[model samples]
Target: MKLLTTNTLMVLLILISGYGYIASCTHDDIVPPAQANPTPVITRGENVHLPNATGVADGDTTKWKLDKAHSSVLWSTAYVGAAGLLTGRFNQFGMHDVTNAKMLKYPTPSRGQVLPDTSWAFYENDPSKIYFNGYVQMNTSNTGEPGRDSGCILGTGYYNTVKIIPGYQNLEINNLAKIKTTKVEFDPLSNDYIVTFDFIWQGSLASPLTQSIVGRLKYIPKAAVKDAVTGNVLYSVFGLQLNFQFDCRDFGVTSTSVADVIDIECNMNFNNK
Candidate 1:
């Protein structure tokens, strides 16, 4: 949700050195959309408390609604970090998480060599549907230059195409992103709403091929998550189920002839959450 270019440092340099492309970051606003029900993610008895002020109370159970105009979900997370450092919201933008597409994976190794980002549609007509589309970029440090940092393994682009089944059913995304909901169940043991996603590396040992990245792809949440209304209880999420199956494929070596799909399951909790 920051800059459009894959490399953030390059963006900074372009501004200072007057050699970067004009900033064209496009982010959409997310508000609940009008629908028959608030959201399946939220259940009636999910929360036992109610406010008399017509306003929702703490631990109120509400579905993750979409923005009618944007057709995107308002995914949020909690966090407690330094100012300008932690907004701690689910921070989900209008990503076209669908059948097959490119999505951006950040934290490039350096502050330069920024690449172009692809923005795809996450939804179109109905508010319930979702999509994710962007290109992934990663870099590393291989030199010990002073002041200005440079040199690291470059990475190949990876695309993700996932669907949020109408009824919140379950599916496995790249053997990492698991979604299951023929019947939805709340995880009382966990007090936080959970959405799991995985990123796989698909690079060749070559990048003599410029971006020869040699590491596994993992999904790390940068947004600080917190209880919807209160800015308390901040936490950032990292993938916990990577070892369960095959590790992320290396760049270029991955079989891009076909994309590896990762499924997403979002479960909202009441008390425990």
Candidate 2:
């Protein structure tokens, strides 16, 4: 009886070993339940490419210069005691310094492009690489009406308390530390950057109004121009258009008749000098 039990145990062991060898041989042919459909991981990073329609690379680190000739600041509010809207624009306003107005070309994948397969968080936590000091000369505002323009200028100054100071009436935007580079979206079709930054409205007697302004800065490529006589490339141009809206009450512009909300639009295109 003991001999018979021992033989039964050996037969069971041999069967188990044969099954293991068969499984190993057909490992590639069989699919496990867990691996039948695997989960996908998404990675984010700058996509570098050659100069395309925008004449810039995907991960281009080039610092673009702000073109002042093609730029302007426009704003509109409800007409004081009227039904129509009152729109005005600043004729003399630009990057605090064109020479130093630097922007990075961090291209992102969009328009049905494939996402990276690896994990990368470099841009997500990266600080702002660009700093610009933008200002609007309140005195250069034009609304077509001389009297109305003067009144609007006085009202704007009264709120900000800009005396003989020329550039004191300012619109400062410098917040490098707050920009989340990782989430910055790049539109490949039209070089537009969806960005958000701190906009410091230094006006009125109340205090400097600091608001996080979110908007898109579009880089419009213009037709290439060549020298008339030399037949050589004279210069190239691009347009930077910005549109945004905000509340006047937030900046202390409590005009008796003007509406609380204000609409702003701008266009700027210049050369790289």
In the range 31-101, model 2's lDDT, one tens digit per residue, is 66774545444332352111122322233322233444455677888877789988777665544321213
Instruction: State in Å the error of residue 252, model 1.
Output: 7.4
Stretches off by above 4 angstroms in model 1 are 1-94, 98-135, 139-149, 153-188, 193-198, 205-273
| Top candidate when judged by lDDT against the true structure | 2
RMSD of each: 28.8, 16.5
What local distance difference test score does each model get? Answer: 0.25, 0.49
Worst ten in a row by lDDT for model 1: 175-184
In terms of lDDT, model 2 sits at 0.49
lDDT of 2 at 226: 79
lDDT of 1 by residue, 1-273 (tens): 355565787778768665323322222344557778633453222211211122112232321211212221111111123222111111122222322232223243232112221121111112122222222112221113322122111211222323223322221232112121111123333322222233333234322111211211112222346878897755432221111122223333243222232122222211111
- Residue 37 CA error for candidate 2 (Å)? 29
Itemize residue pairs with steric clashes in candidate 2.
67-270, 70-268, 70-269, 71-267, 71-268, 123-182, 124-182, 159-204, 160-204
Error of 2 at 185 (Å): 2.8
